[model samples]
Target: MSERLLHLGHEVVALVRPEAAEVVGAYEGRIGDLLDPRTLTAAVTPDIDAVIDVATPLGDQAADAAAIAALTAPLVGTGRGFVYTSGVWVLGATEDRTADEQSPVDAIEIVRYRPAIERQVLALADEAVRATVIRPGLIYGHGGGIPALLVDLARKFGAPRIVGDLGVRWPMVYIEDLAELYVRVVTNASAGTLWHGVAHPAVAVKDLAAAAGAVAGVTTEPVVWPVTEAADELGAPFAAALALDQSVSGAAARDQLGWRPDGPNPIVEMLDGSYR
Candidate 1:
């Protein structure tokens, strides 16, 4: 996102953890933890035109909310914007249905906390600051995302395993495409608006695996690993994610912000090595 913002002629101030220096680089970054309110306030000032919160980990939602509240307090009545990044995973799993901004968030116990934070951020629209929340689908790109992990496993093990029917569809977007949505929301999106950042139509998990396998020069077949066994092997969190049947729509973003994603479809990119 920082990279894209820089390319868009915005003066970017990236707030990053000190340990992420190599990953974040020297693009006007402020090394600090998002959990610290004072640190966050110091990193963000009322002078900037907008504040974009892209911090992660659901545990940090409270702190992020607090920080955004603090930052916007002074910007209120001044017409500055605040763009907060959230995820579609907060919608949780559903049976053969696609979720949009208005969908009921019947999330699992693990991510049920997101709706409150979403509400808090949206409430800021009542204030003078323009606040927008973006819910991105599974972010993939640059050979550094989920598909890449599968490709690496395929290359090492010569075959990748799909846990279940392997027919579940998952929404996704390239990192660059997601970044473009963020930039658009910050610069031009309306107050209290929610946007989805998915690019292509939902792709089946098995097809995604096959695409990854082709990129890695290997073959793959569904192994039908039990959910419990997969969780035990891959750790509980990742296993739960694998079990989810999720897809999201980006119609609102396209319609509202005039944002268009021209990036490669994630599965095709994985197969063609263009993602790498």
Candidate 2:
């Protein structure tokens, strides 16, 4: 996102921890840490036109809120924008249904912590800041994402394992496309808007694995592993995610932001080795 913004001629200031300075220094932006309120205050001055919070892990929600509050407190009603990053995981699992922005979040037990953070960020819309939330699906592409992991697993295990029916559908987006959406939302979206950053309609897990196997030059059938057994093998967190069956639509973002996704679908690209 920072790269996209800079490409668009916007002066970007990114927040990073001290430990990440060496890596983040390669990017053309200011680096600071969210945990330190003073660092944020010094980085985001009143002259700044907008604030985009793309910090991750969701566990840093409190510090994010505090940083946003501190930055926007005096600038309220000044029309400065505040864009917060969220995830589609808050929508949780759906039964044979596709979720939209208004869909109620029935997040899996492991990810229930997301809704509270979403709510807190959404509430900022009422505080006179031009705030918007962007919820992105499983982000892939640029050689390292979920699909790549599957390809790696196929190479390691000699076959891509499929848990259960393997028909479960998951929504996904390429990192570049998602980055474009984030740039649009931060720059042009109105206050209180919610956008889904999905690109592909939906891809079946089994098909995705098959494509990954093809990319790795391996020919094998789906190895059906029971949910519990898969959980034991892949660990609870990852296995729980694989068990979820949910898809999301990016129509809203495309309609509102004039955003278009041109990136390759994970499965197709995986098979063609374009994603590697």
In candidate 2, which residue ranges exceed 4 Å CA deviation? 25-31, 58-75
- Tens-digit per-residue lDDT, 24-135, candidate 2: 6446455666666777667767768888777655355576567666655654777778877777777877677788999998876556666766676667778777878888
Model 1, 186-241: lDDT tens per residue? 98888988988888647788888777777777755734556677777777667677
lDDT of each: 0.75, 0.76
Against the correct fold, how does model 2 do in TM-score? 0.89
Candidate 1, number of clashes: 0
CA-only RMSD, every prediction: 2.4, 2.4
RMSD of 2: 2.4
What is the C-alpha local distance difference test score of candidate 2? 0.76
lDDT for 23 (candidate 1): 74
Kindly give the stretch of ten consecutive residues in candidate 2 with the minimal lDDT sum.
Answer: 25-34
